[model samples]
Target chain A: MTALDTARPGISPTAAASEVEAQGRGGGGGPSRRKVGRVLTWLALTALAVLFIYPFVWLLSASFKPRGEVFDNRLLPKTFTFENYIAVWQEAPMALWLFNTLLVTVLATVAVTISSSMVAWGFAYFRFRGRKYLFGVVLATMMLPQAVTMIPVFLIWESVGMTGTLTPLWAGNLFGSAFYIFLLRQFFLGLPRELFDAAKIDGASNWQIFTRIALPLCKPALVVTAIFEFQAAWTDLMRPLIYLRDSDTFTVPRGLKSLVDQFGFGGEWHWEILITASVISTIPMIILFFVGQRYFVQGIATTGTKG
Target chain B: MAVAADTSVTDSPPGRPPRRSSARSRETRAALLFISPWLIGFAVFTAYPVIYTGYLSLTDYDVINDPSFVGMENFRALLEDPKVALALQNTFIFAVLSVPTQLIVSFFLAVLLNRAGRASGFFRTAFFLPKMTPPVAIGILLLLLFNGQNGLINEALGWFGIDGPDWTTDPVWVKPGLVMMSLWTIGASVVILLAALRNVPQELYDAARVDGAGWWRQTTHVTIPMISGALFFILIVDTIAAFQSFTEAYTAFFGSGNTTYSNDAALFYAIYLFQQAFEFLHMGYASAMAWILFAIVLVVTLIQVRVTKRFVYYEGEQR
Candidate 1:
């Protein structure tokens, strides 16, 4: 099921070609024409793929190159060195920022996954009063942009004396994210209701049924949610900028922003260090994407098609 | 709500009324208990902030002092605010140009990927790499790539006997630069549309072909209608994302010492709002701008929903 198969989709290219083959055998335009067409298509796709992947290659190479060679318009570095990476580490608080980000992303991902799943189970299992209305509330929250609530949310956190701390950043996720809740709710709704009924008949509490049955059945969805929350927390720049006050508290994104400010100014071009810091910040996410690309694509596919 | 309850009661055969009632009440209690976290979150984070923003829009609240009731003064000022008008214009241009362009490009790429045969997995992974890159990192990369003299973009254009615009320095290319950036991460929409295309049944295509429809005709008549729901989904999501575009414009144009006069062209709606609230400390004015943005988004969404009703084909709706 998870093999990333094109088998189920309508008419795979090879399948269509075979159908052409089966029909009239040598009567139709021969297989050579189709072979040429396939070759051209692959060539075009390869070029497009290179267009998409070139930036990362450029970023990685530029990060290792000397300052003068930064904008040399070359794919490979002539004289790559570790000096920029070393400079980035020694000159900036990269380790501290990474630690801060790891702490926030892990905690917030766990919090959002737990809270969203519980709420999703509620909306999925129950036929309560105002259930649809509450789901509408969830949908509305998704539409309400952070820009709309920026000032007042900031004020609320500030009034509570938590502005300069990381509390305001991850604390919001503990409440439940609308997107995660909606995603999990869709997954939960697809689950068989008979399982819940069976658990209930066996004298299982709602909590027990949720912990034992719903959660176990929904591991894929949970993984998707965790990946999403972790990515969001890790890549977030605005929230950290707004909430964090000191360099000691800066996340990777905010710290990287400061790096640009500090080194990318006043006729002093530090592109190597800047790019190095960016590459370092991006490595974890790239790793995460490669590891969980299937889940990520599945989540996007599910959310998109279901909508 | 009452209709569902009444329907359930009427639909029941007989002799199970009390049991159903107890079961329903039990479910309701369990539901409330399970969703308590979200309810508290909704009340604190969503519900209160919405109402509070409305209240703040009516007053002049600086961070240091209590707000004074300003009535429509901020709104009145907003009408004459050039920055507000400029930001709105820039945002409108962005959404109008970028959304359709992105949709077309993503759909085209999706079609290519769909036809990619066995190479689909490798191509999918490669294309999706950009979307996975952090915006901060992308900003830095773009800044270099789009640099006027030595950037790779212009260098590539030179090979085609074309003089590329100074993407970072010129005011004329500022919004276009942002638009280009927006298109670079078209993977999300591609994935969505790919899934949509996969969901399109094979019988529809065969039927269309049997009716003498060519590939283009089949795509237009059958495939598009089938996937209109996903198209509309990307439309709304991308529009909202475009309006709130900040990190790229902020990081690429306005970071530290690179803030030139032309950088004003990159002052998007959210970037402007950030300036007002954080840079200038015009809390009340920024609040008013935020409300206007909210109203614009709400109206746009309602309009899209109305338009979708006319054109979008939901599969289960017909039956």
Candidate 2:
């Protein structure tokens, strides 16, 4: 068993043994039968894993193949070349798109993380009137479908003359998303009240206590919130699709959409470049997942169990 | 000790009640100050927009002209629009098929991972990497893999002597193809259900075994009930998400200026709504569509909560 087993209780070794035994041949299986069962389970899992991972592997390999060889269905490219990756930049403004996506993602992630944690701290720490009702409003916002607000929110940005710019994509995040606020509030509530009380008695102002105490204590949650928001901002296509009319302002997903339009069916038929761009766009997220695998698992577990 | 410390900060000399109230008010003020961002955001982004959507639905307003009141006209048009019905039907089909399949598949995947011991982490990561892929990328993958001819999926099917249908070009197979693509991201649900599975009490399974329950019996009786909460949560969430499915289908079928594919089969409700509001600039009609969708989601979610309450076993609830 790994740290995950110990972190979560109830999945002891004997329990696992019993689980395997229960899954054995009708509770009267010999040791050989159980061993066969284990091998079959492993084989089944390996096949499923291959099914899940093969497409990406194909995409990754296809990115390196020559244009006509892109659909040849070989996992290994017969003629490997880096020309696709080199040509992708010349064919499209991928560098600008990457820069735009990075900027927007950073701004949006920081804005949402700080703003949501503050609001969550207020909800979790303070005893204020109408707190329950206000928090209910936050939760209710989570239920309200974005389709309902998509038009008017667009109109709001249009009226402000920011629709054609990148402002509409990241600006709304300054207000703190309801989902992140709710998640952070759970983290804040898990904190002991005495930490803040001790900070209070030491003459720390509310802001100082929030910055110095609550923020530090909830670093894992903060990181989770930031990473979640980063992924949201980076992968978000809808907001950019609506707001960005100019290719210059396009994020990676929007750029990828345009690439699909250009290459897939718009008669360019350059499948290699399109596949390369997809691989390029996917690499950062995969890398982040590997680096932050622990936090990702922890964050997902908390959201599931706590909810 | 923490309670005593907490009270020490709030405790005042008995004669000074006004000071206590003032301190309480100060804390309240600080709290409000801290939460002011959400307050302002709620009013601007959520509250105002929702109320305005309600008003907008009743009028025919293009972007250039002021919204003129046509009360009930937009709603009436929605009823008459054939595309509206088609979109709704398509969305319903997608949701009904996708949600249950995703739930069951993810549950079993979680159960398998739960028993995989040392190999669980690698399998989980492999499964979850797809979920982390951007939806736009997934849309591109859908096009690449599900293409009618020479796609990887069809090539793989040919190995088993089964010819795959033209997924993107054929109207009948479009939504089913999308459902298959949606399963690629079941890793999230699997992770959630795995967490729930790990928390299930071992004794319940032991007791079930003592009663001579086998794998399927113990699963149906003990394992499922223990993780029913997570299952129900994924059901509601995935249902909502399925209704809002746009990015992938849009990118695959409609994102390009080219519309030579089977757009009708892929025209999900949100995609239709998006086209009306953004592409055609029919703000009022789209608003009306939005409200209808809102109502449908609300009703479906309510029905789910009410129906699942009996079956979902909360650990500490009074039986």
Candidate 3:
């Protein structure tokens, strides 16, 4: 039941080897067949890699191209120009949006990390009446669809006159998210009980043990939590769309959405600016992913394998 | 002698007989203190919103006026609404198409990466990069790549001597186009399934081979069962996500407030709910739609759990 509770919508993979296996079997048998199989596998993988990476490559290339050559489908831009980037800055509030996104993302990420780790520490370290029930509730929240919560949560902020303000975006994260708490709790539980006992014997209070011992020891998990939350907040559009009515208050994704509206769909047809803004918004997250690649993989791997 | 000495010495201090209970209570207090943030958040953000939404579903709410009690009126309207049916149909089609495709593609990619061994690291990073792209950006890319005429996708298809449909403009092709776009972010799934694949002991494959199992047999019997738990987790998660998919579709079709595109084709349940709650100010109707979505998801998830229980192979668990 608890495992089911933690089932937030995510991604996964499949297995079927009929044609490939047949191909492997048909080849000049034994070692030659094995060699053929390996080559085929490499080919398939490389082809898929290109399919996956091409859009970003195209987007990047298009961003540097002039408006006419943007969709020329060539890997290299025929006429490379940074004019789109230059004009994007002048046309839209890109810098202000970036700042707003950074502020909200930082606040949300930091708040979720600290708060979730603290809650996780409680779940991991303590044995109390109703503890299981409390943890169950935490897990259960993950199962609640955002659609169910969105309107009422918006109304709550609206009632408080926090709508159209950046406060609504990060304020809820101060309470900690269920998924992070669960992830951090798993990390916390892996810590040996003896460490806390030793700290207690050394006259360190529970709070002292939590701050000084648990947190530092769980740095990798903390980094994972921070990275995940940072990405989530940075890319989050729904909350911003709901709460942020003004252009100045919009986050990067929200700003990008507006740019898509303006350039791609209805407004003016300066698509190069939209493409430029899209690339600009994507780079930070791409850099973050590279920097925290190890932790990110480990964290996602644990989520799948553990529960 | 040590056991006798320990029993004689007592665990507590000589003058502190009640210390154990006090210490237990103190620890409980400390635990509560630590988890208070989650508790506060749960009450306000989760618990309250859920209950309030339920209440709002029963009323006529327009955000400007007070929510008046109009018991089940919104739910009744939801039953009569043609758009509700259309939205649900769109969402269902999307989930049906995207979830299994995602699972299969990600699994296949994971298998490829798993076999790649040392070279897997670079490929895994390459594959996972797209998952890092912002949803809004993905939406923009979707419009650009799938742009019916003179689009990169159509141009690529032209090279293969196949004509492409007007993906953004045509109603029939819109959902399919969205599914194609969804495939770009299967990186997380691939990484997850790869982890699961790596966890499958080599002994199982060796044993299968010894028993005369071929590559296909080994994959189906040994490799798949070993990773069924992870696969099941992904299935449930992806299904729920597919149902709730908002950002990319919203950004692509509805974000611009453009009436040119076939918006009905992309009118997903969550998107309609958004339109109702925010755009149309039909807060009560949206709340009702939300509850219906919740109920539908709950039933679907429960069905999945029941159905997969027999098939999912949790290691060391007794049959």
Candidate 4:
């Protein structure tokens, strides 16, 4: 009997007898079945993988193909060119949009990651009256949909005269998100208490412990949070649309939106232009996912298990 | 014994450091430093607006003109405002219908991808790309997809001798049009739920099988509990996100001829709020609407938190 057979008391022997009746490892044994299973598994998987990945591949390839050949069903490009990409950059405020999106996402991610780590440390390690209740209050904000806050936030932004610029973009992150806070808190909680006691014995303050100890330990989870924050702020359409009025300041998603305004079929600004922009916009995120897929996978798996 | 007693005494000196006092002082300072941004943002952006809107709902305050207080008027006026009632009703209906479908579709898709194995990453990213795609871009793509004449969907329907509803123009189909569009993004939640599913201890499944438990029973007893936490989180978040729907509603269109397309069927709370705040410039009234939104979300969220605890089974905890 094989190792897997240990659990199946009655069936293992019966299955084994049936297996012996057929042949040896040629086709009867569990190992052979596993091999067949693996092959079939791989075949099925490869098909699914292709289906998932082909659309984006086609999209990117189409972006490079000539405008006349854009919708052609050919998987390979007959005439490849960078002209579409260049024209998208030259024709519209694509550069401005890229610059604005990068600045906003980068700054916002930095603010959120640092502040979330700091606040999360406070929640994780500190002991004070109403601390539990206050933490609960923090988690409470997460449950409220951002839509409900739209008018209220807009009114407040208008009153402060911070509505139009890139101010709202990164500024909101400085306040931190409940998810990020809870994320770091859980990671910190999972860590052994001895480390904190060791730091305390050395006469290190909470800030020292936070900066030198807890923060470093939670790097994996924090990196995931940073990536998430970056992606969120970068690709956001709703907030930028509501707040930004000026064309010069439009973020990438917002800029892409303006491309469709009253425009008809394939002109200089049609299929080729929009397709190229879409490919360009998704490149960074795709790259981000590939580079950190492991940590990203782990991050999603472990986050918010406690609360 | 003497040496052990000496070690015990030495473990903590009689005059131990005054960590309690220091920690208390440090906590106060740390809290102030750590919370400064949230304090500012909440006070300036959230708290102020929430309070101001509550106050504003009772008054006629135009930015260009002087303020006037009128109590219970906006609430009474809201009852009479068909638009407000319509928007609220539409928002709830849209959320109620869409959230469950999105959740089930995503979970099942995750199941498919998970079992599909080697192709999982490609499918995961594929599914997730649309979620990451700009809503404007999606709205544009979906616009093409839903077009009655040449659009892909109707064209497919035509082959079966079924002339699909004019999705853009028909009031009956307009909301469903948005719901279909919303599905493009469930890939995000799918990614999340998929990850959670991976953490379901394989040994538990193995144990169930040894006990002759089938797939469905195994899922119910073992797999469900392992990842129920993540499922709950996503459900609550999805509900909130669904209710907050906008942008898509606004982007949907037929032609200038129909204006609002058979009826104002596409209008939801956020769209209506946008119109009130920016288009119509009813600043005070919109602020009041914001407060009502806050209350509704708060109550809903609280009930969810209160109730979900009963249904969700953590790894080791008993029901």
The TM-score of predicted model 2 comes to 0.94
Estimate the overall C-alpha local distance difference test score of candidate 3: 0.86
Off by over 4 Å in 4: A1-87, A262-273, B1-23, B116-122, B154-165, B252-263, B302-309, B317-319
Q: Write the per-residue lDDT of candidate 1 for residues B240-290, one digit (tens) a residue.
A: 888888897887766557644467788789998988887777888888888
Q: Which stretches of model 3 miss by more than 4 angstroms?
A: A1-30, B1-17, B317-319
Residues A1-307 of candidate 3: C-alpha lDDT, one tens digit per residue: 0000101112111112222333333434534554565677778889988988899899999999998998788899999899999999998999999999999999999999999999999999999999889888888888889999899899889889999999999989888899999999999888899989999899887889999999999999999999999999999999998889899988999988887777766665677888899999999999999999999899999998877
> Candidate 4 residues A131-157, lDDT tens each?
788778777677655644666677667
Instruction: List ranges where model 2 is wrong by over 4 Å.
Output: A1-30, B1-16, B317-319
lDDT of 3 at A266: 69
Per-model TM-score of chain B: 0.91, 0.93, 0.93, 0.86
Backbone collision tally, model 3: 4
Better of 2 and 3 by lDDT: 2
Cα deviation of B59, candidate 3, in Å = 1.0
Q: For residues B1-319, what per-residue lDDT tens digits would candidate 3 score against the true structure?
A: 2243344445545686555665666677778889999889888988899999999999998988999999989988898999999999999999999999999999988988886645788899989999999999998888899999888999999999999999988999999999999999988889899999877765565566556666678778988998999999999999989999999999888964586556899999999999999989999889999999999999999999999989999898632
Sorted by TM-score (best first), the order is 2, 1, 3, 4
Off by over 4 Å in 1: A1-13, A20-28, A265-267, B1-22, B255-258
A117: Cα error in model 2, Å: 0.4
Using Cα atoms, each model's DockQ against the true complex is 0.50, 0.51, 0.42, 0.28
Candidate 4: residue A250 Cα off by (Å) = 1.2
